[model samples]
Target chain A: MTTTTIPTLPAGRTIKLGLSRIRYEVKTYFRQGDAVFFSFLFPLVMLTIFSVAFSEQSFGSEAAPLSAAAFYLPGMLAAGLLLSGLQNLSIDIAGEKGDGTLKRFAGTPLPVLSYFIGKIGQVFATGILQAAMLLFVAGVVFQVELPSEPAKWATFAWVFLLGVSTSAILGIALSGLPRTGKSATAVIIPIALVLQFISGVYLGFSLLPEWLQNVASVFPLKWMAQGMRAVFLPEDFASLEQGGTWDLPGVLVVTAIWLVVGLAATRMTFRWIRKDS
Target chain B: MTTTEPVVSVRNLHKRYGSFTALDGVSFDIHRGETFALLGPNGAGKSTTIEILEGYRDRTSGEASVLGVDPGTGGLAWKARLGIVLQSTGESGNVTVREQLTHFAGFYPNPRDVDEVIAAVGLQDKQKTLIRKLSGGQRRRVDVALGIIGRPELLFLDEPTTGFDPEARRQFWQLIDSLKQDGTTILLTTHYLDEAAQLGDRAGVIAGGRLIDIGAIDEIGGAEARVPIVRWKQDGERKSVRTSEPGLVVAKIVAQLGEPEALEIIRPSLEDIYLQLVADHAAAEAADLMENAS
Candidate 1:
């Protein structure tokens, strides 16, 4: 029989649970072949295809020139972040909701905050691996040089962290938008694809129309792509940017603001069960 | 907690979704160390009532206390003392049974050994197999194992044996019987009346969103509903008499017709009484509708 007095849990129990959940999330995620191929491999495959296609081309002026492969490196990295953080998390969580995983957890003593920590931790871990793979392929096959200065690497680290964080939170918020698990990929893929294109991942940022660039500027993906470009491109390659400068400050402001917005939206929308269920 | 204090108390609980009333003024109490079965047909609000008590859904109006705390305001500490096996299995299909159990065991302060839970559910042979590869019955055992792994004081089993074979179900009943012996307060919901008879100490029968009867498993439909009937064929007509003294009625019949043809005494089973109660309630409701229409 249940005791009249409820027992208090040990201190740091939630943290321990959250940390263990990360292992579960990662293990389960890698087991799904479809999730791995689509979220983890799609960007790398695209980079390989694009790099070979533009092998003969050169970007930037003679003073600080860049090969076409190096130019597309940052764009592919940005797309990888979006795929791993936003696209993957949204679809995964929506499936969890539709298939009753969230409902099961809701009945347990697991804290909702801990669940988020596990998810975001997954995104962070996968994002690092995706970045490393992208960097390796770029360096070995394409002979693209990475930044050597500690400041440039420092910028890369923060940008990667902030971009992944913002995308993950927004993904959780967007999981509520799909009506069913079957329809989640159908709804999320188009949105992610459109963001990538508009944010200068698949196409050149300056080549796009002013109105389209302005629309992309309202989103964090555009800033994230620009920040990646700052870390990887030559100093004089700033001329290719819309403002003829690496707007690192602007990237920070926009990504941080989206992080806040994503948090607010998730708080408002996340549910263990669907509205109709 | 004392055995006299109800582990679960529900009063005037009502739940409405739009114009549809899912649960209407349902009330019951389940005491400590007792298994209370909520029996109903599909869409009879059994799940809704259970969900409200499990803190998964909110009631429109009601007073519900589970383990001395209102479910609406219960925290993680309160949830830790309860185990819920939802109607549909909700575990991730990617992990093995042992891995899933180990993961969930970490959530509770005091949990049963993962291997012991596995052995209890008779899944020792399939413990290392991925859950997705398991058969329906095996998957259900995994569900039961997860529910008991936390060593919950109060366990809620919602249609726990839905897909089990007869032999597996019997094995499950034995496991539940052991848990009962351990003094766990349990709330079970199932459409199988025999399951209720076998496991429940008391039952609440719900139909059309209302509890039609509540009492001990054998005495649920009242003494009147349980009266034995002596039936016979005489004068080319079938005759039957409802009587408490079924033996006396048989003797009187034998005296009158020198052993009437095809004579037999019919004692109502729980299933029969339950069906009769639901049918009578439906007839009464139809009459009320007709009067209102007129």
Candidate 2:
């Protein structure tokens, strides 16, 4: 250990550092077998179950025949996004906090904000990839039709981006609530399962009780599923919606609100170190 | 040494959590190219003080400057000058040792070569192993590797060798010694008194959120505290005397006893003084509590 002169590091090195963090996050996520399974395989399993049980069944009246696979395809995609962006992401972040990973990062020169940006980037990328896989399976095996026109695809892009961003941010924020790794699943999964049932992912929004619809509407998952339905479902299917219309603009407004709220909550609740109390 | 500005300095630092005080009016300085050790038991505020210096926690009051900048508002450049090895780190265990080190090296503008650091920590053979597959002691080597990768001007080691075996601990000491030789200012906290005596130029003992004593390692408890006890057998009875000058006492005993039987000169080890200091502090604290209760 000879005396090595340390060069003064340049200020504002967060960009490069954050990029490195993102690279590590992506690499680590792919390498972990459980993470790979949950993000990619678990969603596929859920899609298979729903499609097998309700493929030929049609909902609503004889005027419009909406097959169960088609109706549930959009909902399944929304569920996939939620599973990756919210459930998996939150548990991972909370697990890091529980095990002292966040605390260790706090001691480094790397900015805490950069660490979060890296995590969010990983979540967003995984969510997109999982959504694409689910879409492929639904379109090919289940024979569900995707959006044809450019406008509907555009809707899918914004809704997917906004929904994933909102959930990722919410995951980062809710990570602070879990005290340990053992409790992270308990803390995040119950909320995810409840939202899946009430937010029209496992069941049709119109079939759910009116009061339940109103309650679920306040969450991002409901808006995400509604937006996806608008992008995939036909024009007449809007009659079965809560407002008896697609309400694409309302979906955008609701999701945008969630994006803002999630970011704010993350800023307020993110903890670099887990307190024992 | 007095003419040079301290690389790390603290003045009346305080940290409080509601009604509880973690650090109370603690002050110290580590000169450039010096290895300063902080010795204390659990909850003695050693970690709280170290965290404040590392910019991981904020102080309730008083001033602290590391590398001439306040840690509370230190920017990234300021942080780049520090190498910190926490007591217990939670690392993502999926990555290999080399991959983890390579990723961390990018955070600094100029960092030591990753392979060189891995070799310095004696982990060259295990660089390709996943962190989770490594033993507890081997993982600690990774922690140390990350700490020194940036060639930091000052390294903060909080119990850097807690789980290490005897050989590993000695190797770690040599690594620290080499870093010190290269003129990197070091501030470390350890519960092991021998570790402090072996590596520290100076040591401070903290108890009950206060720095009770600070001085050169050999003189931490003061001249009186370092007094040696001379024990000898006289007329089939044991006799002992404590004195600052052991040689003089021994000669006098020999002159009186015509070569004393079973002669022994026992000096107070750092551990002995440390325990005495903590015990004294606990007694004082209990008395204060009793007085307040009455």
lDDT of 1 by residue, A229-252 (tens): 999998887887888999899999
- The TM-score values for the models, in the order shown, are 0.94, 0.90
Chain A TM-scores in order: 0.96, 0.91
Q: Which residue ranges in model 1 land beyond 4 Å of their true spot?
A: A1-3, A62-65, A274-277, B90-92, B229-266
Task: Provide the lDDT at A155 for model 1.
Answer: 96
Q: How much is the lDDT of residue B134 in candidate 1?
A: 95
Task: Give all candidates' CA lDDT scores.
Answer: 0.91, 0.85
Query: Candidate 1's residue-wise lDDT over B60-147, tens digit each?
Result: 9989999999997789999899999999965559999999999999999999999889988999999999999999889988988988
TM-score of chain B of each: 0.92, 0.92
* Candidate of highest DockQ: 1
Give every collision pair in model 1. none
Tell me the deviation in Å of residue A188 in model 2: 1.5
Q: Which ten residues in a row have the lowest lDDT in candidate 1 chain A?
A: A268-277
In model 2, the runs with Cα more than 4 Å from the true position are A1-12, A55-67, A179-181, A274-277, B1-3, B232-239, B243-263, B280-294
Give lDDT tens digits, candidate 2, residues A157-230. Answer: 99898888888888787877777887998888899999999998887788899999999988888989999888
lDDT (Cα, tens digit) per residue for candidate 2, span B123-206? 999999999999999999999999999889899999999889999999999999899998999999998899999999999889
